[model samples]
Target: MTYTQTTPDHDAGTPGDVGDVVRLLEPDGSRLADAELDPWIADLSPHELRALHRDMVLTRRLDAEGVALQRQGQLALWAPCRGQEAVQIGTAHALAPGDFVFPSYREHGVLLARGARPEGFMLAWRGEEHSGYDHTTINAAPPQIIIGAQTLHATGWAMGAQRDGSDDVAVAYFGDGATSQGDVNEAMVFASTFRAPVVFVCSNNQWAISEPVTVQTKYPLAGRAPGFGIPSLRIDGNDVLACVAAMRWALDRARRGDGPAFLEAVTYRMGPHTTSDDPTRYRTDDEVERWARRDPIARFEAYLCAEGVLDDSALAEVAAAADALAAEVRAACIGATTRAPETVFDHVYAESHAPLAQQRAEYVEYLAGFAAEEAR
Candidate 1:
């Protein structure tokens, strides 16, 4: 079956076309109507809308705490998800419990929505663990550090699900920079050819480290997927309602065995690429200020308030909840202790091998020398 484009031809693209983005809520907090996308989120009640706002608020607080911790030398590094809260929270909310997610290192909002503990979220960044949480427990893999590698992993898992005759879909979340990686292209090739049940979400935050996205591709990022035979949508990543609708639409297609779908969420990264880099060196304050006005949480909050779904009291409650969670995260991160150095050798082999046993013994002995020297 041929994949049908969900967006208009004018919006989908030509070589020079900058695709018209799909949006439900304007940057100014006004709502727009889309016949094709509206029904996907029509069932969302006022309570659910309020909940989305709360999730974004909490996610931002978590991001803030992460940045502060890294600055204070608690976390080794942190990828701030400052301006992309809507894409993460909205897509995450659309996901079913059984759907698996393979996320890049910046998707803290996704991890939080997946019910991952805040303490667990900090483990890897704290340099205390290889993986923050068990993939089997949450149906989501640990945040992948290698750019675009998770796309291949998600495609492989989607193929596995197809072979097992299961309708379960695998979703891969990556940044715009990952699209330039060969692994992402190869994964798309396999996914399209095999008609694997997968959704590829590209959060185009307009920057890949010190480089701007304009240098990454001349055409819209969404246009690249169609060449691989996957239908794609480009949406306003800052608009939570648009995100929810677009993700639900893609998820439905995958569940129906229609094959893989791609979504490009156009957003801006309002902070540095990571705690280790200085964004000011690459981007001008004027540009940053322009994007700041389009902040995802503020936009969503405005919409909620306009709709009478949220009031000053409700906003205060959300703020209190966010503050409490931020405090919990800070305390947990600060109090976390590193594991015994020797334990690193424990999981190398499931069953101990003779060589591994010998190595472990030598390592333990090596550590003992430090203890002896300290005693002296």
Candidate 2:
């Protein structure tokens, strides 16, 4: 699963013909001038820049805690977002309060940015609840477990918003693997045909579990959108500033009824796909080490420090906040109570149903038989 960077072919009509990836912040903390993107983030203040850095630090801390909890048997599983914090935090920060989000299972950073409580995030992983937060409250859907499904949900929601004549945009976050799914293509089709006000964000993390991106496609993922008549951008996912600018561009277009846009955030997965996965078997330590050098948090920290937006005290404050959040999440996950098994049937229907009631009764009786045998 070692990734080798290939030069994109600029041949017209070819998939690799998509323009260069949009990058505003270099890996070494230098700024790359982009006239089109500069205006998008030009109004950001020093405080806002510090906040972005803090968000990345907090996200990485949360991810670390999640991995530890799963390894310690506190959670069923955890999908690590170690190297993709910029993609999540930056895009989420660009969202308006009225905008809706549809996310894949690994979007904890997005949920956090959308104001979801840390405790609520642990509920689903602990098997104590079906969803972590109220979708209506945050204008985001529950994390979709099925690969590529959230894209369809986002498209449908966007269509609904268009019908209601609302300017709010719908954003869907998915992994590179999901782009290969039929649901994703179908979503693009419907979105393009109707000019749906949606943004499709593909976090191209270079691997789909054990498979490398090369196995999926030889061309850039962003190029696929053009075939559906959707404009797209390829962005450097490790640069938070670029992510924010790119997302703002896409969101603006969607809000203006310019139809759906696709974004391919080129990033790498520095950790295992999930706590249950073993990266050592499928990827090299060298590859992981190389990506670590481009660590999103570290890069952003460097940039902020250079700009005098953050000093030692500011860094320490952010670290302390992250530590506090991680502790809170850990305690909540460990202390969460397991629900009754019968409760699975509780939300199966909106209201009472005759057949469902009978089935529930039979299940109850079956459980009672075990108790009767134990008593005897």
Candidate 3:
């Protein structure tokens, strides 16, 4: 799909399969005195602005809590989505229900907005299976932990949508780190050649583990997909309005039979790579603090408060709701259904391999043998 960004100064995209402009609405909340922001705010209804702020705040808290859960040994590892909430949630909320999403590991915010229960994710961190949810229930794909691998699945799904004559689009959410992966590049080629109705969204958080984005690409990440014959845009990812507008533009065009779009949401990753990586060993506290000042939740909240819709009561309600959500998720995580002892061997092939089944049967007999010995 050909996409142009919507800015306060510029109109969206022109019709007839043309590129759109990338927008930066309300640059720094109160910091930047851009007169253009007022009209943008007026265009966005109060409810939409509040929803954007609330979802970002709740998701950030979820990320922090997930980190604590890992440290407490409830999880093997946790990926923090701290500074990228605005980009994820905004683009997610802008999507229509018919649209499908293929999310990378850190897209907790996107999953939450899509009504994915956090309990589904716990099984993966607790040494169990890694598929977050059944894809048939929601328009979301399973969580792909293998970095940019989701791009391949996304491109394939988009091709299927085209063959099935469905106008619904597909979105693949990845990070700057994944852009270096061969799977991501291969996906661009697949989608471009097929003219699939897909949106490749790169949440370029400016860090890939310890390596800076500079090491990943000297050129802008958005420029990568265009070479594959796909149209693309780079937006200020921290700005919710900009991100949502970009998604809307892309999805609308895709639904109208335009090809795929590649979106680079320029944001920052403010936390460690995972619970295992101690960012303090390489990144500075000053760097984290600097991004903290530009926190997506904080900035969005300031805008909401300025608009006067985010009252003290609304703030308290959101906190209480978010805490309740965390409590529910924790309770569910603690008591997820136990896996069958031999489930690992059940789906290993088209039909169960006889040798594997024999081994599982032997293991069961051995357990029974121990039980009989204890009885004696």
Candidate 4:
């Protein structure tokens, strides 16, 4: 089914089809010639293509390690991106250095792609910090834990960038469930009205926790954007090339002052919602197995192999690099130092706020009194 219920005003695509699921790679690992998308990816050398593959591999490894850490009690929670690596990596690579990204909590691949240090990247999952990296350095905001709030943040940031006369754009990364949120809808309205240079990327991974996408909307998520006077596209999220091409197109439009755009990436979540969730409770093994056959990494590996871009040695090197990354993340997570209870007050403000200062002092005195009583 297309993204939404059709009216005579339905301007998205043909009614019965899947609403223009853009693709440049077939499931069998063959690349198709597309005039529109080819130019966007033409500059990528063979070495660069291999590096993209490595990025996907390493990102997946990082996610796997995070899940394992959570299971082993090193982390309070972990979000898996097992089956959506291609979409995250592809779109992240399309971003310019000056561009800003506002991401949902599950965007581990985006974090790694944007150059977040593996050690710091897991700090929030380990319950150690409010954010893992400096937003100024990465040009990416910390992952937003509150549903669709980041969309509003991105729109506001983009408005500021526009007023500053900069070519920089902002992107909001959210999930399928987030599109149903009133905050996201309101953000779209503001973005459209103000013509903000923002891109809204919805990774429709079939399921939002236990609820299916159908429960969220009767039509494609992309269909929601046109109502706000923004252009939108629905693409095959499993195809990395399609993601890169689509993102480039959308970013170009935003940078050219054509206002905002929306992208709906059709993918699947192979793992549970988080380490705390159980997929078997809601989904069937057969369905998961079907998506497994369409694995993005496997298809990309096959394409690279077919193109003579990867040999056994190269493949071995990529695997080794992924393993090394996982090791680094694990060591960082295990060796991370826990802060004292009082330390939580350290970074709450840039300059000391009187009220917080008083509260911190009072709490410290209370702790000291308890220690003195225990000594007696």
Q: How high is the CA lDDT of each candidate model?
A: 0.89, 0.87, 0.76, 0.87
Clashing pairs in 3: 1-259, 1-260, 3-20, 4-20, 4-21, 5-20, 5-21
Please provide, for model 4 over 1-376, each residue's C-alpha lDDT reduced to its tens digit, 9 standing for 90 to 100: 1232223234544322333677788777899887767787888889878887999999889999999899999999988999999899999999999999999998888989899988767888898888878989989998998999999999999999999999999999999989878999999999999999999999999888999887777666777788888888788788888889889989999999999999988888899998989999999999899888878899889999999999999999999999999888998899999987787788779888889989999999988998999999
Model 4 spans > 4 angstroms off: 1-20, 365-376
TM-score leader = 2
Q: What's the CA RMSD of model 4 in angstroms?
A: 2.7
Error at 99, model 1, angstroms: 0.4
What would the per-residue lDDT of candidate 1 be over residues 48-141, giving only the tens digit for each residue? 8988898898999999999999999999999999999999999999999989999999999998999888887798899888777877888999
Clashes of 1: 0
Q: Write the per-residue lDDT of candidate 2 for residues 1-376, one digit (tens) a residue.
A: 0111233333422222213567888788988899878899998899888878888889889989999998999999999999999999999999999999999999989999998887778988888888868888998898999999999999999999999999999999999999899999999999999999999999999889998887788777876788888888788898999899989989998988899998888888888988889989998888888889888888888888898899999988998999999989998998888887778788767797999889889989999999999999
Clash pairs (backbone) in predicted model 4? 3-219, 3-220, 4-219, 4-220
Best by lDDT: 1
What TM-score should be assigned to candidate 3?
A: 0.85
- Per-residue accuracy of model 3 over 1-376 as CA lDDT, tens digit each: 2333222112332211113324454434653333432233346678787787778878877787788878877878888988999899989988878889999889889988888777766666665664656666678987788989999998899899999999888999998889899999999888888888989999888788888887776656666666787777677677777677778767876777778888888777888888888888877888777667767777777767786979999999889878987886677667667686666565456687778889889888877897899999
Candidate 2, residue 258: the lDDT equals: 92
| lDDT for position 287 in model 4 | 84
Q: What's the TM-score of each model vs. the native?
A: 0.93, 0.94, 0.85, 0.93
Model 4 TM-score, 2 decimals: 0.93
